[model samples]
Target: MIKTLLFDFGDVFINLDKAATFRELKKLGLEDFSSGMMEQNQLYEMGKISSEEFVNFYISKIPESNSKKLIIAWNSILLDFPQHRLEFLQQLKEENKYQLILLSNTNDLHISWIKENVSFFTEFKSCFDAFYLSHEINFRKPNADIYEFVLEKHQLQPNEVLFIDDTQENTEAAKSLGIHTWNIDPNTEDVVDLFSTKSELF
Candidate 1:
């Protein structure tokens, strides 16, 4: 029986424009996303570096761009959080049917933006039994260690967990460990129809 539900935050719960960051950076004259920049991002997501350092890294690259401009560009990917999804999550929490957990590969700047913009961020977070952010946990998705960390931390059997993510790479990694997965396409699907869509699992 699936007793635990592991969910990805972006694109699964909150809407995100995965391309918005690249586009925004281009506008800032960063025509190419260099390997160094990518490495810095992963480091930031893993909490290996502080937010000030992360912002400074970009600032050093584009000396004309200040911290505020870089932060706004970095946070351009986040979009609106739909009310219906929050309602759906609340109902699921009230039912107490599954041990809901949220796992996301996020950094400080993005989360800071969300906390400031999303009015019900706290309420939505309260629905989860555990909330694991990449920066806090020192791990990110598509990495086997991260998945193992969650399973071991919760003392959960891989077979008893249903991992839902918008990224195929993430879902596939979880599946390799015997967890059930749903690679949700946010454009065509709404998490509110979980029961109707994944009825067999329920």
Candidate 2:
């Protein structure tokens, strides 16, 4: 029986333009993501570096861009959080049938933007029994250690937890650890239809 519902944040609850960052960077004269920049991004996401350091890294590469411009470009990926999705999650929380947990691979900058833009951010977070953000936890998805951390922390049997993420690689990683997963397609599928879409699990 599935006792826990593990969810991803971006492309799952909130809408994200995955390519928006690169497109916005192009406008800032950043032709493409360099190997160093990508490495720095991973470090930033894992909370190894501060936001100021993150912005400085970008500024070092793109001398013409200021901190404000870099921040805007970096945060362009975040879009909207549909009200229907929040309602669905809130209703699910009220049902109290399963333990709802949010596990997201996100950086501080992106989260800050969401807090500012998404009016119901706190309510959305309150729906989760436990919330784990990558930067806060210093662990990222698609890594066995991160999965192990969550499983160990909750004393949850992998078989009894269903991990839902938009990325196939992330879901695949969880599956390797014997966790159930749904590699949701944000384009055609909405999380609000979870029960109808994956009814057998429930």
Top TM-score prediction, candidate number:
2
List residue ranges in candidate 2 displaced over 4 A. none
TM-score of each: 0.98, 0.99
Q: Residue 101's C-alpha lDDT in candidate 2?
A: 93
Looking at model 1, the pairs that clash are: none
Q: Give me candidate 1's TM-score against the actual structure.
A: 0.98
lDDT of 1 by residue, 1-202 (tens): 8899999999988999999998988888787889999999999999999999999899888878888888898999999999999999999999999999999999998998999999999999999999999999999989999999999999999989999899999999999999999999999998888878888987
Across 81-133, the per-residue lDDT of candidate 2 in tens digits comes to 99999999999999999999999999999999999999999999999999999
lDDT of 1: 0.93
In model 1, what lDDT does residue 24 have?
A: 87
Model 1, position 19: C-alpha lDDT score: 95
